[model samples]
Target: AASLLGAPIGHDLCIISLSDLMTPWERIEKRIRAAAIGDFVTAVYNPKSEGRYWQLYRLKELFLEERSPGTPVGYVRQAGREEQVVNLTTLAEFDPEQVDMFTVILIGNSQSYEAGGKFITPRGYYGEIKMKTDVGIGQDIMIRSFRTIEKELKDKEMPLDKKWALLHAIHTTADFDMENILRIDDHAVASLYEKFNRGEVRTIITDVTMAASGIRKGALQRMGIEVKCYLQDERTIQLATEKGITRTQAGIRLAVQEHPGALYAFGNAPTALIELCDLIRKGKATPAGIIAAPVGFVHVQESKHMVKPFVSIPKLIIEGRKGGSNLAATLVNAILCYNDAEQLKPGRDV
Candidate 1:
């Protein structure tokens, strides 16, 4: 493989038969001197045998004297056999006597290690290992959207045409202030920006009040990603524009895209709820078809006229359902996992 790689143009290559068979020592010395001066990543095969041994040292010395001490040298014994041993070390640390007729040695150039790890050398370029965060979202509603994405990544079974399509699909998250409305303060925005830059997140699900507007929008655009804002207030919309956030109004806003999908969840403030209904009425968004908490504290009640049109409305208790959060989470899990629309029932929708 080395000789085949080097056989181009006017560069002369010399191969010495280190085995005690055909080539003479005087001729080998001449070739070695020429090779030492030329500076190449030489491959040595059949450097040792049970009968003859000293030639390996001579070859090593010839290369070592000319090349830098820290140059990478690889030794492979028994090539593809079961007992194969491949060791990579510097020229200064190589032990030539260990080689035999079945062994191969590769002497690399100085910049070899700096270029990348050896494993990636099989490819055309260097490799990189940037610090990354593995998203650990559970198999909840927020995670179902990502489930398809994760499968596509793990399969790597797609054809070349479909590969990039899967990669470009949105892997997102939606957050509703269930307990306390999580605000997007500057600190939170900064943290989110870092995560977005690292490809740890794509779609951000947050309400308008959690943050100032212009920074998140501008920063996300600068990072070359899409940021969809769910359940935004009028003030948050202004702030989102100023923050340069990639604003997609409410979950249904994403339906305007070329590929329309259901919102990850169905519960938010009444204003957001009505916006979702409007989208559904317009045929722009489908009911996620899952009720989040059916018998819980609903802030909004369907009007008498709308109640005839909607099946989701009911009387609200003074306090929210016990473990409303857990029930919502469980329902989302069921919907996402079983692909059962029935999961939306037994509880409240939005």
Candidate 2:
């Protein structure tokens, strides 16, 4: 396919004809490579016919080498005619087999994005969309901060759930190092949201009261999820005194005995996480999920390593000794608001 740049309406768009009927295939390929290297939004005409089936596939492979899989691609068939058909898909999902001689394909440039079911190429101007008046200044500032973090993200091609949680983690700590430390299981956020929405998992057990209190009460109330900490429980104190174990470790035992299926979160006590791991191994507790981010220099690294073998459980872990109560709570917030992931919207209950 010959790629062409057709910039109309003062925007740069390259139009290339892939028809080899009147042009040499090698010359057409050279032009396509140049357009790809130039990062031009491209349009292809006569992409495929019965004799030209493999050409479109090669064109797609060439573009992929220079483009993000998230790049938008749209196609129209029999344009300006009653039989016209339009389709929008990503470059990763673009199907060459669906094209014919009558179809015209348009691929988005680096700055182009898909919005509202249409491919949008910016005309070099942007305006800030104001939030509602009732959202308050703090929420507005937080939203702005999220946008800034998003723009500076090193890898913006991650899954929506991971990206959503990453924004919150970075916003809370203002630590760019979090981009490298945060590790989330595939579909963990979405699967937990489904469970929470169905009221399957309703309790969260934190290693300390700080983590329990850090989570927003409004969101917990709205979701009907309880944040529980057994650190101050009389039974935990007694268990620690009798067994000569750390109070936090004893607290996990009491919490697990009471709420075996609760979502277990750790932010300040590695000993507590290790104790839970012991319980899980012994079949004494089966948690809904785990957030292993207990921050410390002691057994912090080991505690995280302890939980990784249970691949069946959904988990979110901060790999190093760089986690805290705020980080743990923000991740919980990410799960509570995951329905807004597609829009990158947060603080629904704020």
Candidate 3:
């Protein structure tokens, strides 16, 4: 059966006969229940015959209790013989009349599927190679850059999401040192992806106009997310002068007040990052995430360290004072790239 079906029975499986000739009906029922509960792919032999008709119906009913209606079920009659016949169907659509003593019924696990006239039960390595091949042909440079980064960081212990984000950063900056210096909270970037995909994030607040300008406008427009920088606003100037604070800091305060829960990306001013952390700590603002990468020596490290304790919010921080507007924009674009890749349909141009 395995040879005929291209190794569908390679995983956990059991074989049960429903004839009840040598085995009692109660024992066969118990075995079927055990297979179903154990999540084992089952093969039924001698399912039905002229004298044994009701047992196959009972077996299907019991399996349906534990399996999904759409679970793939394949039956092969007279396997490896001249009169061999094979048919693929789901558990809900299986006809007991088509199965007889010479038929072998193979029931798949929950992860199985029927495609291209074949039934397949994936064993965890299903689409790994296909995805790589697709990405290789679709985006050659991106795939090559990712592979190079993966090779370089082979020994580094980091989460997969962080590795992907850092790969884009290194690809943009061409600086390998950024890999070690970047600090990402666990699942931080993934949280951003979730918010972005769900359309929950509607606005992006940037400290500088340059950072805002760097974000992909078309992508943001398609996603219905607005990029805003209040540095040029008249209100920001008045507030900064009155409070004796930097214009970027005042802009952040005002932006947070106006666009609560918006993502904040700061690339030029350490004061802006510091102000955002202070505002969040004071309960004056609640942002979706923070991408703080202020480049300089003065208070840069301090400002980044201030945001480190914000464990609840997703953050992508360049640990030292080694970031600039370009890196910040690159990080934002990296997120957009991920979103675009997710939206890419098979056989469609990326």
Tens digit per residue, CA lDDT, model 1, 125-184: 122432121222232332234323423243322232222212211221222222221111
Cα lDDT of model 1 overall? 0.40
Higher-lDDT candidate of 2 and 3? 2
Ranking by TM-score: 2, 3, 1
Q: After superposition, how far is residue 63 of candidate 2 from its true place, in Å?
A: 4.1
Off by over 4 Å in 2: 1-55, 62-67, 109-116, 120-183, 213-222, 231-247, 341-350
TM-score of each: 0.31, 0.71, 0.58
Q: Model 2 misses residue 192 by how many Å?
A: 2.0
Top candidate, metric lDDT:
2
- The candidate that achieves the highest TM-score relative to the unseen native structure: 2
Model 2 TM-score is: 0.71
In what order do the candidates fall by lDDT, top score first? 2, 3, 1
Expressed as tens digits, the lDDT of each residue in 1-350 for candidate 3 is 65466435556778888886887889989999999877778988988867889998888888777775556788999998999998888787899988778999998765455556767654443335333233445454455455445445533445556766787678768888887788888887777877887998888888999988888776686677889999999999999999999999999989988997999998899999999998998998899999989999999999999988888988999988799887787777666556443221111222
The CA lDDT of each predicted structure is 0.40, 0.82, 0.77
Residue 190 displacement (Å), model 2:
3.2
Per-residue lDDT of 1-350 in model 2, one digit per residue for the tens?
A: 11221222335667788876788889989988888878788889888877778888899988887775667788888877788888888887999988889988998766555556767654442244444334565665665577567656788578988888898999999998888999999999888888998999999999999999889888899899999998899998999999999999999999888899989989999999999999999999998899999998999999999999989899999998989898888899888889876644467666
